[model samples]
Target: MRLLITGGAGYIGSVLTGMALEQGHAVTVLDDLSFQQDSLLSLAHHPRFDFLQGDARNPDVLGPSLEQADAVIPLAALVGAPACDVDPDRATSVNLDAIRTLLELRRPEQRVLFANTNSGYGSHPDAVCTEETPFAPISLYGRTKVEAEGLVLESGNGLAFRLATAFGASPRMRFDLLVNDFVEQAHREGVLVLFESGFQRNFIHVRDIARAFLFGLENFESMEGQTFNVGLSDANLTKLELAERIRRQVPRLKILESVTGRDPDKRDYLVSNDKIESLGWRPSYSLDDGIAELLKVCRLMPRRPYRNI
Candidate 1:
C-alpha cells in the first residue's frame, strides 16, 4: 500500500508514517511544518518514505500527492478548542474545507481514513457515546471535525474514527492535550489548576492512535463508510481523576480546583470502543502506561511558550 498522510509531521501523523513504513507500505507525508516540527526527519533515509513540505489546503501540493496514494489519511487540522478559537476562519478552512477539497479531488477507488475527534459528542452525562451518538460539538474545533467526518462517511470510499483525547508522547510533542499537559505541568511546576475537574472524557495513547489508522487501512474494504469510536473504554476519567493518576508518579504535585472559571469544552461523556473492539481492534497502551511514558519523555523536552495540538 502507498499512503499519503497530510500533516505527517504532526503528533499523530509522524507516528503513523513510521508505523506504515515498518509494515512495508510506501508512505509519503505532506506537512507545512506550521509547528516547526522536525518529527519526520529520522524517517528520511527509508526507501519507502518520502515527504513534501507544503500546506494541505493547496491543491498544487495535494494533487500530485493524492495521485500517488493507495490510501489517504488527512490528519492536518487546527486541533483542540483553544487553537480553533484563536482563529475561527483558518480552523474551519484547514479542518473542514481542506477535507471537502480532498474528497472532491481523490479518485473514486482511493480509500480515505480520516482522523476525527470524539469531542463532537459534547455532553451525554448519563449515557455512553457510540458511533451513532448525536454530535453536539461545543467548540469550533469539534464542529469542524463533525462536519468533516460527515463528508468522509458520505464519500462512500471513506472511514472515520471518532478519536478520544490522545495522550502519551510523540516526536512532535504537544503540551495542549489534557493528559500530556497535566503530566508536563506536574513534572515541572508541581502545581496546576483544574477547571471543571469533574467533567469526564475518554483518552488514548498517541501510538495507539497510529495503530487505529493502520487497522482502518487493513480493514478498509469491509469498514468503509463507517465511523468507529477508537478509545480505551476503561479510561473515561474526569480532570481530577487524570491529575490524580499523574500524582501517583509526581507525588509532590498539588492540584487546586476553581469554581469560578468555566471550561470552554463542556464535553462530559464516556465513549464505547465496543464498535471497533467487536471488529477485533483493541488498545494496547493503558492510561497508566501513557502517564509513566510521559514522565520520562517530558524531562527531556524543552519548555516551549506555545503549543499547537
Candidate 2:
C-alpha cells in the first residue's frame, strides 16, 4: 500500500515511516519540519520513501501528496497540551481544520486513519474509559482532538484510534512525554520530581503505536467509522508508579515528592484497549521494556538541561 503520513517527520510518524518502509510499503511524508528535520535523515535515501516539506493545513500542499495514497495517516498536529495552549489558534487550524479539509478531499475509496488522543476523555470518574466513554476534554489540545475525532467519524471513510499517552523510543525523540520526561530528568539531575503524583495514565510504546496504524490500515474496512481505544491492558500507572519505574531503571536516581503542585494540563485517566484488542491487535512492549530502551538511548545522547514546559 502507498501511505501518505502528514507530520511524517515527527516522533511517532518518523518511526512509523521507517516501519512501513521496512514492511515493503511505499511511504510519502508531508511535514513542515517545524520542530526538527534531522529525525528523517536516515530514511531520506530509501527508494520507497518520499517526503514533501509542507503544511497539512494547506490543501495546495497536501493535495498532490494525497493523490496516489491508498491510505492517509493524519498525524500532523501541534501535539501535547502545553504546545497547543501556547498557540490555540494554530493548533485548531492545523489539528482540527486540517482533518476537516482532508475528509472533504478524500476519495470514497481512500481510507483515513485519524490519530485521535485518549486525552479527549479528560477527567473521567470511572478511572477507566473505552471507546464508548464520553469526551470531556480539559484543555484546548484535548478539545481539538475530540473535535477532529467527531469529524473523522462522521466522514464514514475513516477510523479513529484514541491513543493512550505514548512513550518509549523514537528517532525523533520527545522528552515531553511522561515516561520519557521522567527517565531523562532522573538521569540528568539524578532526581525525579513529582506533582499530583497520584494521577493515573495508560501508556504504550511508540513502536506499538506505529504498528496499530498499520493494523488499522490493513483492516480499514472493518474499522471504518469505528473508534478504538489503543494502549496496553497492563500498563496503567499512577504518576508515582511511573516515577518509581524510571528510578528502578536508573537505580541511583533520587526521587522527590511534591504535594502542593498541579499540572497545567490536568488530564488524568486510564483507558481500556479491549476493543482494539478484540479487533486482533495487541501492544507488544511492556513499560519495563520501554523504559530500558529509553534509558539506553538517554545514556548514548549528550546530557542536556531538562524542561517540562
State the lDDT of candidate 1 residue by residue for 85-112, as single tens digits. 9999999999999998899999999899
TM-score, cand. 2: 0.96
What's model 1's TM-score?
0.97
Candidate maximizing lDDT? 1
Q: Model 1, poorest ten-residue lDDT window?
A: 300-309
Off by over 4 Å in 1: none
Model 2 per-residue lDDT at 74:
94
lDDT of 2 at 117: 84
Clashing pairs in 1: none
lDDT of candidate model 1 versus the reference: 0.90
Clashing pairs in 2: none
CA deviation > 4 Å runs, candidate 2: 305-309
